[model samples]
Target chain A: MKKLKRSARLVEMTQYLLSRPHTLIPLTTFADRYGAAKSSISEDLVIIKEVFEDEGMGELQTHAGAAGGVKFIPKMPKDQALIFAEELCRQLQQKDRVLPGGYLYMSDLLGQPSLMNEAGKIFATAFADQEIDVVMTVETKGIPLAYATGAQLNLPVVLVRRDHQVTEGSAVSINYVSGSHKSIHTMSLSRRALKEKSKVLIVDDFMKAGGTIQGMVDLLAEFDAEVAGVGVLVESGEVESEERLLRDYVSLATLAGVDSKSKEINVKPGNYFSK
Target chain B: MKKLKRSARLVEMTQYLLSRPHTLIPLTTFADRYGAAKSSISEDLVIIKEVFEDEGMGELQTHAGAAGGVKFIPKMPKDQALIFAEELCRQLQQKDRVLPGGYLYMSDLLGQPSLMNEAGKIFATAFADQEIDVVMTVETKGIPLAYATGAQLNLPVVLVRRDHQVTEGSAVSINYVSGSHKSIHTMSLSRRALKEKSKVLIVDDFMKAGGTIQGMVDLLAEFDAEVAGVGVLVESGEVESEERLLRDYVSLATLAGVDSKSKEINVKPGNYFSK
Candidate 1:
C-alpha cells in the first residue's frame, strides 16, 4: 500500500490537476508512473506548469493528439491562503468577536468578503505546492488577507502602505513597534512591488506583538525577496512565533486567554482545515 | 444562420452546461434535439441542475450510461459577466487610484485579492444561475469583494455588522447618507447567518453615497432575504443612480467628479464586467 514516487507522482499529479474543472492527464501516463522519461515527465510538467501559470489557477491545457493530456481548468484556486484562514477562524469564533480581555473584535473579520472568501480558501490550500511569486500584506488590516493570498495564489498582490504615498514609485520604508509596543507603524513598499530572489508568500490578518510580523520580515529583507511562507489569520499563542518564517500556517481561531469572570474564550485549531 | 430553434438550443445548452466544472449531460440528447420527452428531457435536466447548483459554478453528473452523454463541466461562465466588467474598468482606470476629488482611491483596490479574484469570478459568473443563499456584505470595504463573491458562489458569507452589541441577540438597523446627511449603520445577523428566503448577494468594495449600498438594502429588507443582485466594487458616478438598491454591478473603476483639477481625475466606465 505504498507506491507513490516520481516526486510523489508529481505532487499527486499537481494536486489532481488542481481539484477539477477541465481535467485532463496524459504525457504517457505521467511517463508510465514516473519510471521517468517523456523527457523527464516533461521536466516535471514544466515545473508544475510554471507554478500554475504564475498563480491564476487552472489553464495548463497542452495537447498534441492521440489523446493528448495535461488539462487542469477550474480557475481561482490559490484561494487566498484558505480564504484567509477560513475568515480567520470564523472571526475568532465570534461571540461578538470577543475583545476587551480576550481580544477578537477583528473589525468584522477584517472587513468581510464572506470571511475573506473562507479565509482565502484555507490559505490557498496551504500553498498548494509552494513556490509562490508574490502575496505579502501589512497595512491597516493585512490588506484583505493579502488580497486573499493574491486571489488564491494567482499571485500579484503587493501593498505595504502606511504612508510614503505619491503613488508608490520608489520606496521600502519600515519602522515597526505596533501592537502593544505602544505606537509607531510605518511600513511602505513598491520598489516595483517585489522581485529579486522572488518566492514570497507572507500574509496576515492578525497577529499580536510580533510587530506586524516583524514589519513584514524587515520588508522581505528589503526586497531581496525569498520568504516563501508565513500565513497568519489569528495567532498569539503567547506570541513568539516568527519561528524562522513558519513554513505553513492557519491559526483561524486561537486566543486561549481571558477569564476574569468569564471573558473565557479558547478557540485554536487551524492548520488549514484540520478536520 | 437562424437555424437554432428548439428553445434556442435549450438556452445555448443551458449556457454551455453552466460554464463548467463538474461536467455531466444527457437525458437523451436533450430529448433528441427537443422533439421532447425523455421525461421532458429529464425535466429540463432538472431545471439545469437546479440552476447550476443554485448558482455556485456547477455539478450535474448523472451518468446512467449505455455510454451516456451529458458532459458540461464549465460552471461560472456567463463569460464571468464580461470578466467582471473588464475587471471593474481596469481597476477604475488607475493613475494612482485618483482620490481627493475624483475619489477612486478604492482603499487600495479594496485591499486587493487578485482584483478580488476577478471580482469574484465576475460575480461567480453572474450568480452561476441563481439560488445563492448567502454572501452579503457591508463593512469597512465590502469585505474583500464580499468574500470573493462568497468563494466563487459556494456561498455562506453573511456580515452586515455596523453596531449591534449585547453580543447580538437582535439587530437589523439602517439609516443612510454615506458622504453627508443621515448616518447610523448596525446590521448583525447570527441567527445562524441566513435562511428564511435565502437568495442574497449584496457585495461591495466601494459605492459612496448609495449610502452603504442603501444600508445593505435595508439589511436585506430586515431578513425576509432574497435580493440576489446588487454586486459592486466602485460606483459613485456622483451616486444618484435615480434611487438605489443595486441592479448587479462590477465596477473596477468609476468616479467622474472633483476633477476641476484636483490634479486631474474624471474616470468612467462602471459596468466593467457584465452578466
Candidate 2:
C-alpha cells in the first residue's frame, strides 16, 4: 500500500510475477500499487527481464495497449534441461533400482521435491506453447509431477483414479487393455474434474508400451476433451514397435534395457534432447 | 556468470532465494557469483528482506558469522490464511459436494494448484519452528497436499500406500484399527522412503474420525520416526467426542454439518485461527 522505492518495488514485483505464472497483469495495476509512473514501471520490467534470461529463470513477455501488460512464462533452458536429464539418467542407472520383472524403483526420486520441481519445470517448458486448460495424470505416483507442472503452468490438475471413489460423485469409467500384460483395467475420472472440449495435457511418471497413456487418451475422449500434448518422465525403450500403443509424446529419459540377471541397467536421455 | 549491476543482481538474488527455500546460501557465494563485495550482497538482502515482509510474501532469515548466510522461510500471513480458509469453506459448502455416508467431494478443490500452494504455505508457517526432516501423508488424495507442503518446506515427502506395489521393492507395513469403523486396515511405507528417527510432519486433505491420521502416526512409529506436527485442510465437526481419535492437530476448515434432505451444508474455519 505504501509507496516503495525502486529497489524494494523490484524485489516485490519479481516475487509477485514468479508466484503467479501465465497470468497477465496490466501495467496500471502495478503502477497504481506502487504509485509510480507507467514509464518507470516499464523501465523496472526491462531490468527484471534481462536478469531472468541470464539466470535461466524464465521469460517476462510484455504487451502494449490498455488491455495488455505482462505475463511470466516459466521455462528451463535446453542445456539446463539436458543437465537435469543426465543427472536423472545417472540416478536411474544404479543397479539396485532394478526391481523384479524389470520395474525400476524410482519412488525415492519422485519423492524428492527438488527433483520433482526440476522435472516439472522441464515439462512446463516442453508444453509452454500449448493451449492447455488442465494437466491430467493417473492417481498415485504421477500426482506430484502433474501438480508440479500444473503449478508451473498456472493450470488446474485433473486426476484420473484407478478405482472410482464415492467421494468424487458421478464419474465416467472406461476399460482399456494394458500394454504389457494385455489385461483389462479400469480408469475413472470425475465428471466435474474436467470441462467439456478442454485442451488437456497428459503427463505421467513412467510409460511402458504406452498403454496407460492410450487409456488416458481414450478416457479424455469421453469428456469431449482434446489431447493437447503428452509428457512423461521416463519411457520403456525396449517396447517393440507393434506393442507401442502411443507415438506422439515427450520423455525426459528412456529406459533402454534392464539385465535383471546381470544387475545391469541402461538409461539414456529421452527424446527430449533429440527434439 | 558475468558481473551484474546492483539492479540486476538484486533481481537474480531474490529469485534465487525464493527458488531454494530453507536452504542456507552464504553471502560469499553471491559475492563470488556477482564479483561484488560481501557488504554489497548484505545490503541487497536488506532490501529483499524488507520487501518480503511488507508484501507478506515470507521471511528472509539471515545468520551472521562464518559459515552463515540467509534462509527463506515461506509463510502466509494470518489474515491471508483466514481469507483462504473462508474461500475454501464457501467452495466446500456446495450442496452437491455431500455424498452418501456424509463423504464430501473435494477432489476438484484439491486438484487446483493455486489453492494447494496457498494451503501448503499455511501449513509450512504453522510448523515453521518445528525441526521437520520430511513431510508424510497416506496414499491417493493426500499425496498432492503432502507434495505441496514438502515443496514449500524444501523437504522430501514419503507416501504411505494402502496396497504395497511390487515396484516399491521391500516395504514396512503396519495394521491399524480405524478409529470410527473399528476395522483393521493395512498401511505400508517403503523401507527406503524414510530414515530412522526422522522428525516428520503429517498432512492430509481431510480428516473425519482421525482414524487415517492415527493410522499414519502408528505407521510412522514402525520407521522409528517422530511426529513433529499434523495438518489437515478440513476436519469433520460432526464426529462425536467419544469417537475423536486425535486432538492435537491443525485444520484449515471444519465441516460443521450436512443436511442431506435439504442439501444444506454447514462449514466453518478450522481451529487454526483460534490458536
For every candidate, what share of the true interface contacts is present?
0.16, 0.91
- Give lDDT tens digits, candidate 1, residues B75-163: 44555545555555655565665544344454445445656655676666656677676777764456666766665564556666565
TM-score of chain B of each: 0.36, 0.97
Error of 2 at B55 (Å): 1.5
Runs in model 1 lying further than 4 Å from the true structure: A1-41, A49-68, A71-267, A270-275, B1-116, B120-144, B149-159, B162-275
* Residue-pair clashes per candidate: 54, 0
Candidate 2 ranges beyond 4 A from true positions: none
Q: Per-residue lDDT tens digits of candidate 2, residues A1-275?
A: 46989998899889989999999999998999999998999999999998888778899999888789999999999999999999999999999998888888999899998898899999999999989999999988999999999999999999999998988888999998989999999999999889999999999999999989899999999999999999999999999998999999999999999999987999999999998
Candidate closest to the true structure, highest lDDT: 2
Model 2 residue pairs with clashes: none
Reference-based TM-score of each model = 0.29, 0.98
- The DockQ of each candidate is 0.07, 0.88
Our model 2 lands, by Cα RMSD against the true structure, at: 1.1
What does candidate 2's lDDT look like per residue over B1-275, in tens digits? 57989998889999999989889999988999999998999999999999988778889999988989999999889999999999999999999888877778888899998899899989999999999999999988988889889989999999899989999988998888877678898989988889999999999998989998999998888888999999999999998998999999999999999987777899999999999
lDDT of model 2, residue A93: 95
